[model samples]
Target chain A: MTAAVRRRAGLRELGLGLALPFVLVVIWEAAGRAGVVPQGILPAPSLVAAAWRDWAFADPGLGLNPYLGTWGETVLFSARRVFTGFVCAILIGVPMGIMIGWNRMVAGAVDPLIQSLRPIPITAWLPFAIAVFGIRDAGAVFLIALGAFFPIVVNATAGARDVPRNLIRAARMMGANERQLLLRVVLPAALPNIFTGMRLGLGIAWTAVIVAEIVAVKSGLGYVLWDAYYVGRMDVVIADMVSIGIAGFLSDRVLVAVQLRVLHWKQAVRA
Target chain B: MTDAVAIRGLRKVFEGRAGAVEALAAIDMTLAEGEFACILGPSGCGKSTLLNVIAGFEAPTEGSASVFGAPVSAPGPDRAVVFQEASLFPWLSVRDNVTFGPRMLGRPKDETDALARRFLDLVGLSGFEHHLPDQLSGGMKQRVGIARCLILNPRVYLMDEPFGALDAQTRMQMQELLTHVWDQARGTVLFITHDIDEAIFLADTVYVMTARPGRMRSRIAIELPRPRSIDLLTDPRFNALRADILRQIREEAIKAMAEEERARR
Candidate 1:
């Protein structure tokens, strides 16, 4: 397509993206009003929006409503777990991946063990997490960390392994020591792939947090999701779901933003 | 000083999946200080193998290499290589790639920047300092690669067909740029290529090698005047050298083809 036609399509995409969500909301509100859909089963978007507004702004009245004016606190709780878990994942995972990738001895000793353990789901570790940490912040953190770690470690290993042999040779020719090659060449070269892994890992961390919060732990958006469901406040449950999505999206956006900044060199290749 | 690089009876063998194959055999060569020498031969003649061995990226099975009277054991700053591909870190800007060595060696940032800028200008990459490898054309990326090696101020440069991947026009242009850069900082360069015109145009001497399990066939000194030009390609002396080398290579190809046919039979 010509540039003008391509741009026109882009504008259409923007319009459609905005319109689609609005259309969904309108259909939902109509269904709720017409009673075509059972209100107890599926709350209208308008009702959920109102509940979210109240939960974010209106008084709690001694926590009677549970969610009232505490939406920010709940979001903060989940966000903190994800952020801490992701940071821990990166701190441990990236170096571990580098070692696993660069050293045959490390790869031989650790790779099989990691590969064997990787297929075991993070949810399976929940009971162990709860048992070990006893239904606290650490338990949720552990679950999130474990969930995020696999993608980060695996991607880091692949990235480090896939480092162009010629670049390493070039560095070696230029008299770079082993440490210099790892820190300067392998790490930076692996970063683009690592960022891809980070984004995927962050998404899993969000899911793990919700799972942990709903079962082994309390407090956070996931706890509120379950709590509101138990009390027959379907509106709050729907609101909580949207809140979780927005939280996850915003957190992923933060990672993408960070990726863009760090990979500025890769970006420069375009222009 | 002794020759910038001296290799005597150098040999290399590779353990291929099929079997052990000799890459280079009984190779003997010397590159004097400030001379541009090209090792030109057919593919798999081990021209690149020789370059790699001299750069210490690979170990020779026999014999040894010495640089400036020092026994060469491993790659050091004094010997920088320009691979066939630029191999500039795709994730680093042209400027950063050029300055990587100095920075890692703990030279202060200002010093590194100044050195990088000088080399960038020297290699005609002054305007492309901030661009990434992917942003540049094949020729431009190779220029950055040259600038990177130039920045190191290495005593010897081992360039393996640095411009071989460029288009015809771009390849000629790179040849000119290389000559220009070589003029600025005269270092012993062991450039490897299969192109006769390229070898003649760039080198003060061209060493022709016989095919696989390669050995030095002959070394011809090009008396082509310095500050050379594209016009020299048509000169009788140039064509004479090209024809001689072409005949040698053609005979090698025919002989190798006959051997292959026999093996197939």
Candidate 2:
């Protein structure tokens, strides 16, 4: 197909994505204005937008609402938790994956246990998390880290294992020692797979953050979501829900941007 | 003359799901120093298996092979292999791939860079040093593969159908480039191919192999003079050698198949 035609097709998809949300907002606002439903149970999109604005910009003389103008802090709290957990997952997961993939002994000893433990949901560990860390940030952080770690480790291991045997032999023929082979050859070969794992793990981290905030500690978008749901502030609850979505979308977009940069070489090959 | 590569009664057997499959049978051969030897055969003739044994990537289940009088055991930098697939590390830059051996062996950066640059230029990839393997075409990746091994300055070049995957034009071009490179370097080359024409064009001595349970059926010495050109392809002498090798390979392949059928019965 012509480049122009392809680009126009892509633009159409983007436009649809942008327009659908606005249409949903308008419909919800109209529903509330006409009073077609009970207002206490569900807030209009307009009301959510106003609460979002208040939380974001903190309008003049906002009274007794600690949430006003504090969107950045709440965002930062969740972002930090995700970031710390994600980094920890990568650091531990990558090396562990390499060892497990490269050595049969390591795989036999460690892979089976990790695979078995992986089936247990991160939410299932909430009680144990709170019991050990005692309702602190560490408990939330632990949950986030645990949640993100599984996918990263598993993907990294498979990636490393999938590296071509010829490439390894070539490396050895080039006088690469075991350490250099692992670092220079195996690590880079496994990067694309590892990045795939990281993206998956980061998504899990966000989910774990919401779960942790709902129970383990009282902070972040998840905490705000739960807190606003109580006392019947449906507008704030809707706004908090939107905030979580935006955070997740933005986080994923950041990852895709990095993936584009790291995998640009791969693109031309396909082209 | 000292034999650069010596294979005396070298045998290899692979244990399969059914039983022991003999990949090579008492394969005894030797290449004189700086000779260009082509191992020619049909598919499943174990030509690659033989190359791998000499390359030290596989151990012979029965006999032994040696390189430069040293017992072949494991892969080492002294011998370089060019695989059918480029088999390059995709993440490394072309220059980095070429310099990989030297850098891994702790050669000085200046020396390695200079050597890499020379080989890249030699392979006509001078302008594409910083490019990743994925960025290059299949032919270019193969060139980088050759350059990487060339930069290592290995004594023996064990190539297992390195250009077999390329299109006709690219394959011809690679063949010419290889001859040019070999002329300059003058290293021992053990080139393997299923193509009779390729064998006739490139090898000084063509060692024809029998199909599975591969043995060296015969060796044909090509007296075709050096500084060979593509024009030689149409020459009557070239066609004669090609026909002889093809006929020999076809007969061997038929015999191999009959043997297989007999065993089944």
Candidate 3:
């Protein structure tokens, strides 16, 4: 199809996707105004949007609202944590996973330990993190890293293990030594899986950051969410939830774009 | 002078949970330097196992496989291979795939680049340097496979049914291309295939193999003229050789089918 035709199709798809949500929001607003729904307990979509606008654009000096002009800082604080933790997970997870998948000894020595630890939820580590890192950013970052690590490593291991046997033989026949085989053949073969792991790990990092911020850190969207709830600012709470969803969705899209570029050969095959 | 490839009393038994399955039993073969040899057999007759042993991809369970007097132990560039599936690295462009061997051996970049151009041109893939393996046709991918091995300039070429996956027309074209390229870059070759016509056309000496636990049944030398082309398919001598090999392979194919039927039961 032509680019223009494709773009129109994409726009149609977007329109189709927005239809249900738009209708629901309109119904929700009608219900709230008609007092069929309790406004205090479940604010209308308009209320949430209004609150979000003020959270994002209102001058703090003119308003008594603590959330005024705090949206950007709150998003940045959470984003930075997720970024740091996700990077840490990738740095440690990818090589370790590849080694585990490539070598029997490494798999035997490490895979069991990871498997056992993986079953313990990140939420369960909250107390331990608080004990070690003392309710600071370190605690939140630690949880985010720990939460993201499993998927990255597991996916990396799977990627490495799934490399075609013939490709390895072909490389060896081309005079690749053990190290060269791992770096050239095995690593490239495992990349698709590694990226899959990174995407999953990044999602978990976002989750981890929220969980960490809510309980262990003093600032971020997660902290604002809980604080808004305690003070009964339901509109701000809803706005915060939507903000998290958008951030998570945007981050995933970025990772997917990178995956397409790196695995361009794969894209050609699929196309 | 040492034989280009020498296999003596070679055997390969694959040990599975189902117990030991004999693949090649007490096989012996040799190819002189610059000779083009094909092992013709029925499907599942262990012809590929024989080639694998010589390629150093598999160890002989009983005897030895040697290349240029060195006992085969591990696969190396000196014994480059063109696999049945082409098996070009999917991520690499055509040019990179062709130059893989030389680059792996740490050859100079400019030298390998020029060599890549020549070999890719030899395989008629000069215009597809940037195309990824997945973007190429089966015949094109196999051309890259051939070019990669050619760039190695190896002591021997181990081809395991490299054109077996293509359509008959493509296969014939590839055969012609291979012969043309082999003429220019001559090396000892050990080709494995089930096609009677392909064997008759390509081989200097055709070794017909028996059914499972394969053993050599006959060795018929092809006395066809060089610069062989598609026209040779209709030649009386080619048909005679094909007829003789076809009879042997049919018997083995029947036996193999019977064996599979019995196993299923």
Cα lDDT for residue A2, model 3?
100
B150-261, model 2: which lDDT tens digit per residue?
9888999999999999999999999998888888888999999988888888999999998888899999999998888799999999989988888898899889789889
Pairs of residues clashing in candidate 1: none
Write down the DockQ of candidate 3: 0.73
> For each candidate, what's the DockQ?
0.71, 0.69, 0.73
What is candidate 2's CA lDDT for residue A235?
Answer: 81
Could you tell me the C-alpha RMSD of candidate 3 in Å?
A: 1.8
After aligning candidate 2 to the native by TM-score, how far in Å is the CA of A16 from where it should be?
A: 2.0
Which residue runs does candidate 1 get wrong by more than 4 Å?
Answer: A1-9, A18-21
- Candidate whose TM-score is highest: 3
Candidate 3 C-alpha lDDT tens digits along B64-90:
999989999999999989999988899
Error of 3 at A14 (Å): 1.5
Kindly list the per-residue Cα lDDT of model 3 for residues A1-271, writing each as its tens digit. Answer: 9999999999999999999999998999999889898878899988999999989988888557788888999999999999988888889999999999999999999999999999999999999999999979989989999999999999999999999899999999999988988998989999999998899898889889998999999999899999999999999999999999999999999999999999988978634
What 10-residue stretch in candidate 3 chain A is worst by lDDT? Answer: A262-271
Better of 1 and 2 by DockQ: 1
> Model 3 residue A108 lDDT?
97
- Tell me each candidate's TM-score: 0.95, 0.94, 0.96
